[model samples]
Structures are given as structure tokens and as C-alpha cells.
Target: MAEVEEIKNLETNKCKQNKRKPWDDGPCLDRWEIEKFDPSWNPSGMLEVGSFSRAYPKRREKHLLKCWPRVKSALEEHGVSCELNVVGRYMSVSKTKMTRDPDIIVKARDLLRLLARSVPARQALKILEDDMAYDIINIRRMVVGSKEDFLIRKIRFLGHNSSSLKALETSTNCFIRMQGNTVAAMGSFRGLKRLRIIVGTCFRHDIKCVLWMS
Candidate 1:
């Protein structure tokens, strides 16, 4: 009887040891449910805004109005909210609840800046891509000459029938635009680097000489 009682107790112990704990199954949680339990798991609710002042808002007002709908829709697809202040001549981008990627706001800002710089909406949208980037180089500061000299240098940069500019674009694989005193370019990092060097050379040396070296 004693032996039987001991065997029964041992069997009970084995049963208890083999039983699974509630935690052993892990938390069967949906995404939101998991976020609810872990505060760090959720993205911040704070709003982020990026604002830009366009250089020629009045001149492009009509075109901007026409393209605003498309731009807004594109931004919406990325969980960004955009607003155009026509009177203020500025555009603003803000993060919304749906925004999860932190880099999206920066990309949205670049898109607006490119549009403001007179880049076509179709081309400007390229900024939203991960591998694309844009830069606005202030050529006004690079010129060390009088207004006439500056004009002459600008003309040289454009070349006869813009052939020089076209060649630079082809060689560097970048799109370049001369807007007033600034030069805006969009391309990959390597392309942009070559563009900056070539543009700086245009201001420093004769375009013909730069072309020969290239």
C-alpha cells in the first residue's frame, strides 16, 4: 500500500512538471495589442512639419494649383499631409498618424523644394525614391566677378545652344537646371558629386577647357 501511494505521488509530480504554463504559449497578440502593452513599440504621436518658401510661387501659381491635387495624392500614399499656402508663397508637409517611416517627412520636404525650384512634378516625384536626391547649389556665391562677368560665365555654362549643359547632364547622369543665381540638380550620389565638380569648374575655368578634360 505504501509503495502504491509513493508511485501515485511520483506520477502526480510528473504530471505537474509536464503541464505547460500560460506564458509558455507566449503572447498571442495582434499588432495593436502588442503595441498597447509595450509603449516603446509604438511610433511617436508628435507631429513633424517641414516648411519651404518657393522662389517663384507667383509665376508658377497656376501650374502649382493644377498639380497640387496630384502631389497631395502622392504624399497621402506615403502617410504624409501637405498644404500649400499660395498667399504666403510656401508649402508645408506634416506627419500624420499613419506615418511610420521617419525618413518620409524629409523626402516629402525635398519633393516640395524641387517643385518650388521649377522641377516638373513628374521629375520632382523622383525625390520620394530611396536612391534619388536633389541639391540646390548657390552659384551666386561662387562667382568672383562683376555682373557682366557673371552673365558671361552663365552663358558659357549653357554653351552654344546648351550643348555644354547637355553634355554635362549626359556624362554625370543628372538633370541640371539653372534658375536665376542657383543651380538645381537631381541624381544619385555619384552623379551629384560629378555635377557639383563640373558646375564649380564652369565658374572657375572656361567651359571648353572643362569639357576637354572631361
Candidate 2:
């Protein structure tokens, strides 16, 4: 009887040792807490922080109206709304305020900036044609100059409007314009080199020499 009692006591002890605690049965710690100890753990790449909208400076009302068609079309696709103050040039574009997704606002801003540069609605809208080309245009615009500079060159070109100058713009990517009597070539560095070669080879007599602004 004593031996049997001892055996029963031992079995009870083993069962008590095997019992699980409430805390142990549950998740001991959060996954993020465990991640701190893990060398290979990483957060997800697609985390959204907040609304991606901001206050943009109001531009010329006439300018906005000129590019209104392209602007309206681009923003309408994303369901974004824009308000304009023609007298003050105070235009505001927002998305989250109206409970709409703000993902496409960045592209809209790009188009707006392009228009603000005095780029024609036709050329500004071309940004929507190809994503790759749009990226290139952004880089080129940054490096070359502002849209204002390009507009100045364009105005000069129309005054001359010669077939040969148009061909130069087409062939060499250099938009040749008259700066007084001399021909000024404005374009990317590559276009400038090609223009120089063309001037040296074929049109030295007519153009004298091509000058580029550094």
C-alpha cells in the first residue's frame, strides 16, 4: 500500500510538471518584437504613410486655362478635382480632402509644372504618351533649362521660319534661333556637337558658325 501510494504521488508530480502555463500557451511575444532579434527580418516595401498631397503655388490663370483641356483629362482619369482663381492665379489640386486616392497626384503635378513652363498643351500632353519618354523629358528639362528658355527660342524660330532652320531642328535636335545676326543653337550637348559638324561640313557659308551657350 505504501509503495502504491508513492507511485501515485510520483505520477501526480509528473503530470504537474507537464502542465502548460497560460502565458506559455499564448504567443510569447509579437512578431515585430521577435523581428528585432532576427538578423534577416525586413518590413514590407509597400507601406503607405499618409496622404501624398501638398500645397502647390497658384500660377497664371490664363496659362491654366490654356492647358485646361489636358489638365482636366489627366485629373479626371484619377477622379481628382482642381479649383482655380483666375484673378489671383491661385489654383489648388487635392485628392484626400475629398476621400479619393492620391496616388496619381504626382503625375498631375508634373503635367501642371510642364504647363507652367509655358509648354504648349500639345507638347505638355505628350508626357502621357510613354512613361520612359516622360522620364527622359523630365531629366532633359532639368539639365537644359526652364520651359521659359525653350519658349524664347521657339518665338525666335517662328520669326525666321525658314525651311533650313526647321530641318536643323529636326535633324540635329538643336533649335536654331537668331540672337541678333548670329545663329544660336540651343539643345542637348549631343545635339550641339551634331550641329557643329553639320555647320562645318555643309552650311558654313550660310550660317557662318554655330554658337552654343555653355
- lDDT, each prediction: 0.74, 0.45
lDDT of 1 by residue, 1-214 (tens): 4443443345445566657666566666332221112323446743655443344468778878899899999988877888888777778888888776667788898888888888888888888876787889998787887888888888888888998888888888898888999999999877887577667655755344234334
Clashes of 2: 0
The sequence of per-residue lDDT tens digits that candidate 2 reaches over residues 27-104 is 564322211122123222123323222332354456667677667666665555665556555555555332233334
**How far is 101's C-alpha from truth in model 2 (Å)?**
9.4
After superposition, the stretches of candidate 2 with alpha carbons farther than 4 Å from their true spots are 1-60, 66-70, 96-103, 132-159, 162-165, 172-214
| TM-score list, all predictions | 0.73, 0.37
* Runs of candidate 1 exceeding 4 Å displacement: 1-56, 209-213
Per TM-score, the best of the predicted structures is 1
lDDT of 2 at 8: 36
